[model samples]
Target: LAKTKPIKRFNSPLRKAAALFKELHANNGSKIIARSTTQDRMTKSAEYFLAGFFGLEWPTNVTLLLAIEDSTGVWNNSLAGYYNCNNSNNYRSAGGNNATIEWYETYLADATARLQKLAPGFGWTPKDSYDAQSLCAYETVAYGYSQFCGLFTYEEWQGYEYSIDIQFAGNNAFQSPTGRAVGIGYVQEVLARLQHHTIDSPIAQINVTLDNNTATFPLDQSLNFDFSHDTNIMSILTAFGFTQFAQFLPSDRIVPHELVVSHLEPFAARLDIEIINAPAPVKASRNNTDLYEEGKATKYIHFILNQRTIPLHRSFPDCEERDDGWCELDIFLAVQSKSFEISQYDWACNGDYEAVPYGEVTNGVPTQTSS
Candidate 1:
């Protein structure tokens, strides 16, 4: 007890294995030994211990481990609306209103890393490739509900679009892979600004209803509140039992406003959700459609989302996509505008709700910075 010493006879892979072996053997269990007389060697705990303990990057280490783990571990075809990066043979395409190229790449990278670990030989790469032939191109550069401008190329100022779909709950099952009619309730676009255009201009005049901290969507299952058209707006509002939307119109940015819920349907689903300072797009569907596979409603809406741009840079535009749609959206007023505007691009909103995903400015008021 007087003199304690550090225990270090020798250190090695063999020693570590032997130590584990003795511990298990001494535990009084035959379960420790296998018929091969040797067990597969494993050192890292979850393969992430090293990264955390030594302050290394989990991404890089996990990637390396995946590279050496196995030739073919797994490829989950079960995930809906995901591009299968592992199988380069087919394009993993998602036909919806969304543009977040970097986000998809990051998602694919992490996913492929896991797949590679599960199945070592099966390599992974994003189908964000363009086919040499026009046959590869759908009838429209943008297909179904997909509003992708540069989906065919790697352009800087690419177009990103988003939308939401909602249908009667009864319509949940009426199509292949679950058939249901779908209508474009809402759509959004993000693209580079025009040559002389500033982020601001003649506002589009959107009447936002803020409840708690979020803007509201109409309740009607089938009201055409097309901001692009006037007559449609009143009908969309009337479909939701609103005596008058003008009364609930948000005057100040922080008015207690509530949007009436007109109908409930299973087809009312969120696509890519992004809670950014930018205007967040929301759902407003015309009909019901299958959730697993892209349907006409989503396809039609997606077809229109890619038409506009967010005006990122004069020459290089930054596009975005909310593949997973959203519900509660908040916004941090940048240069707090008197009011916000909504753009239909082509697919206008009727009774179905339509608004950008909402979020507020991160640091509060906008500040000026020199170039």
Candidate 2:
């Protein structure tokens, strides 16, 4: 259970969210909406977050809604979208694993030789070194520490991080065929809330039963909380047209880029989308010191992931550059309105199109095959 896990106590950001909510005076617990998958880990995470947000008796204050995480293809769960995406389950989705393997062979060659020389006849291969790196991460989470961590240098640890980044890029980000398809559901739901309307039809992977109703899918909620996996979060970022993460991650080398999955979706990652009200339109400061503009725009949208502000103009050209990293709320909604069509969810998930080779697609949307 997350309650008993030592890592849960170390999640300061989750607790920080609760503190921010309190500071904002958002104390009407009944107005809060908390959603998570039926998976035990996610459910427990939601419970822990709510316990901090509301109180120890969170159940009475706010309902914890659970979406199904089954693979039967009978249900649509935005919180667990990969299950509803059949293409995401097939061998084609192994592009990430394959990319990681290619990178492992390249980066771990020296480490394998050095480690094997330390113990001549143990038959240590690159795979063994990779396994040691994996153990370093897992054992740290499971047992709080691992002897395997000190075996690698800082550069090797960086290689390990890049390997994971390549995996996420291929498996769940722009490099995967179903990347946008699996995330379009949540994207559309967020759009509905921003546009102030209930989803009229099942256009993507959304649960129509919940979305079509106003009770479970309220459009006027002041705060919305949803729990999801790291892969889904990566795909969600892609589906939202965050092109900053669209760069192709090469297995041969770690290039300079901002698609680092560890920073983006490490365990207990949080993405906060804030709607700010400004009395006048704001502009960038001349000296880059956060000086206020003469007038304030009526509203602006701010996206903070893992406590880092994502500059909206960096991804969406429609969003004007601002010093505060906020985009006009209306422009942000407009950019998202076109994201559904760009995702090509219907064809990407269910079409008979031939699969594009790995590394060819880097925009989270598959190309149209020639007739």
- How much lDDT does each candidate structure score? 0.21, 0.81
Best by TM-score: 2
Q: Tell me model 2's lDDT, rounded to 2 decimals.
A: 0.81
What tens-digit string does per-residue lDDT give for candidate 1 at 165-264?
A: 1111111111000111011111111110101122222111111211111112212111111111111222222221122221221111223322211211
Q: For model 2, what is the error of residue 110's alpha carbon versus the real structure, in angstroms, after optimal superposition? A: 2.3
> Per-residue lDDT tens digits of candidate 2, residues 1-371?
00000111226888865555554434344555578988899999999998986679877767677888888878789887888777777765667888899999889999999999998999998889999999999999999999999999899999999999999998898898878888989988887887788887877788988889878887656677889999998999989988889889888998998899889999999988877665566555446544456764467788899989999999999988876788888988888878888887877777666666679777776666424
Q: Alpha carbon lDDT of residue 205, candidate 1?
A: 17
> How far in Å is the alpha carbon of 315 misplaced in model 1?
32
- lDDT at 168 for candidate 1? 12
Error of 2 at 352 (Å): 3.1
- Model 1 off-target regions past 4 Å? 1-98, 126-371
The weakest ten consecutive residues by lDDT in model 2 span: 1-10
